[model samples]
Target chain A: MIMKKTLKFAFQKSLPVLFGYLFLGSAFGIMLQQEGYNFVWALFCSIFIYAGSGQFLLVSLLSGGATLYVTALMTLLINSRHIFYGLSFLDKFKKMRQMYPYMIFSLTDETYSVLCSCSAIGGIDENKALFFIALFDHLYWIAGSVLGSLMGQYLPFDFAGIEFSMTALFVVIFVEQWKSFKSHIPAVVGLVSATVFLLLLGANNFILPSLIVTVTVLMLCKNKVMEKVGGET
Target chain B: MAIDYKTAIAIIAVAAVCTFATRLFPFALFSKSETIPKSVQYLGKVLPPAVIATLVIYCLKDVNLSQFPSGIAELISIALVVGVHAWKKNTLLSIGLGTACYMILIRTVFA
Candidate 1:
């Protein structure tokens, strides 16, 4: 029963991201192959920096002769929001003894959705449940990356705009989240903060400021969220 | 054909260290039997949407708005994306359709 519930959650929750990862990961794989990297590099990237956007940025920085410190700092900046990803998962993964590390490592946005929605799944162990979802999504990316690298050996076609698949996927998630909620405070806060920050701080620094402002605003609105919590959870 | 072992090792080390550093935080910082601070939890609820907005605008950051046709192409594409998802409620369909439309719009209309 537990096994059945977790599988259903994994499939239902991660389907769109699986679609997104297949194309984007494959594209990244093919690029690495073309850059004279063997399958090992692609494999390692999937295993390690499983982040889609962060990995792409890292590749560019690496090839451009950016120093290690600079690459690390840029990666930290680009993925600083992940610190929040960690903070949120604190309670969720608290009891998973052996699988805790992997859970933390693979906790991307899509993975979080799959885990968060798993309360719908009856009989699943939180430990194994979230672990498998993370593992499955990571495998999707790995398989896609490997396929792209091997396909690169013979392909003469363009993979140009396919890179935008991540952006498109995010738009899809945005719409889904918008549809699911009556309160638009988070959505509005996100847009206004990101836009304002983009204008004030420049493109590179926008995410950090937007994140800080969004958190601040949400904290101020906590009383309202608590009311919702009292009503729902 | 030959590959440079030194370069491979360097890349591997860099990638490994970086990956480890990222995983170290949530695993280390938060697992001590307490809820995350209320403020952080609230922020997580709000942050993902904002990140999406940044990504959307970032795509347009390089465009020369003076090339009004290109700007029009981007705006239409963005609207088409939002509309497709709203109507069908399927992410794969929305993203795939949006990309196909944007590809054509950029190559032909903006060209």
Candidate 2:
């Protein structure tokens, strides 16, 4: 009974991720296959690398013959933002005990959102719900990737713009976060800094510099930004 | 287009390890401390929105405005996504419709 209840709640919580990951994961698989990697490679990357955007970026990096150090640096820069996610969940995760490492390992941006909004239901175990949500999401991603790789081997039509699903996913999340927040300074800072740096440094190299500038600016304005934004978040 | 199997595996391992380390860093550092520092708390609140906004920009980094077609398909599709989502507030519909629109535009018109 408890297992059934936890599974149901986890399904409900992870429904949003279901759509996003399947499509985006398939997109990654297709992209990888287009670069001549087989389905096994796609499965391995999704299962292990597991970072959505980083895995997408990884395809290009590998095909370009980037060294391991370079690949690691790029992955770090791309996923550095995850560090902030761990901070928010510090207290909640500490209670997880044995489940803590798995929770941290699977805390992608989408999972973080679902976990953040997870509330205790009358009959469901919160930790079990969190665990199941994480597990189901990871599986969906793997399923999508493997399916995409298999389809890529036989699809006759071009999927030229299919990757845009990723962009669309991020936009939806951005809008949702926008609605949730009272103050818009942090959002603006991120948008402007990234846009400016993208134009200055061009697409290939702007991310690191943009992240540095955004973090620096946010830190400098920490007092006022936090005061205005308050503790509502 | 193919990387050596050994090289490919090495790169994947590196990417996985690096990504995991970042996620694990905060818990490792602050899990024992009773109180997270004030600055860290403020950042925990504000960084998500900015990071997400930055991701949006990252996704669009390749849409060139100076070339022929000039990102028209991308612009129209993105606008459709934003419009449909703002109006209907449906995530799957917005993404599905927007992606289908882009696929058609690129294949039929831009082809």
Candidate 3:
């Protein structure tokens, strides 16, 4: 009974992700298909690597015949923000017991944001909810990509701007976080830092540098930021 | 494609390993400790808001403000997202409406 409720709750929370991942994952699948890879490759990549940006980059890298060393380096750089995600979840996921490794491996940007904002609900086992949320999201991704690969050629709808769903997801999350948190300073710092870097370095190269600066700035402002956490909601 | 099947598989495997390694780095370093250090704990607490903010920017990184549409479509759609979300506090409605609004703008108004 409780298990069913948990599944429903997790599914409710993952609804936004369902739309976002289905579109984005299928887009990846379509891209890979255009490069002559089949659904098998899409399934393989989505199931294994599971990083959206990394997988997209992989399609290009494969087409360009990038060396394994370059592939590794590019993947690391693209996914470097994931390192910070683990930091936030280390203690919470420790209670997940045997599921710890899988939780860590499946921590994509969307999953991380959902987990961050998620709170314990009445009558639901928090661990189970978290686990199911991750699992459902993974399933959605795999299904979307595989479907897209198989049907890429037949799709007639204009998906030219469907990718905006991803942006909407992030914006929704950002607004939620902004409203829930007592201190807006951290968010402001992040926005300022990222925008500055985006302008200075341009889009393709700004992520890593922006992340580095955000972390550094947060570390330096630790005392001030911590002070505002006293009455956090 | 420039790469053969075998080489492509190898590259995918390498990418997977590298991605997992990044996610595992913090746990490998700090999981064994009896208690997480104060500094690390503080970062863990505060990084989410900051990171999410950065991600919002990351999503829009490709929007070229100097171009024809001049990012007007993105600007209006995001404002709608923020506005509708703040008023309704409904995640699904906000995202669905925001995305639909964006698609319409790009396809017609900005096309």
Top model number, TM-score: 3
Query: What stretches of model 3 exceed 4 Å from their correct place?
Result: A231-233
Across A1-233, the per-residue lDDT of candidate 1 in tens digits comes to: 77878777666556666766777788788777776776787888888778776777766755665666776777777777666666556666656767877788787756765454345445666566667778888888988888888886565765555645556766666676676655667677777777677677776677767777877887788677556434322
lDDT of each: 0.67, 0.83, 0.89
Each model's iRMS: 3.5, 3.1, 1.7
- Each candidate structure's TM-score, on Cα atoms with residue i matched to residue i, is 0.81, 0.83, 0.97
> Once model 1 is optimally superposed onto the true structure by TM-score, how far is the C-alpha of residue B56 displaced, in angstroms?
4.8
Give the per-residue Cα lDDT of candidate 2 at A136.
94
Name the better of 1 and 3 by TM-score: 3
> Which residue pairs collide, candidate 3?
none
* Candidate with the larger TM-score of 1 and 2: 2
Where model 2 places Cα greater than 4 Å from the true spot, the runs are A1-9, A27-38, A56-71, A113-125, A156-158, B1-8, B109-111
Instruction: Compare the candidates by lDDT and give the number of the best one.
Output: 3
What is the DockQ of the complex in model 1? Answer: 0.41
Tell me the alpha-carbon RMSD of every candidate.
3.6, 3.3, 1.6
User: Global CA lDDT of candidate 2, please?
Assistant: 0.83
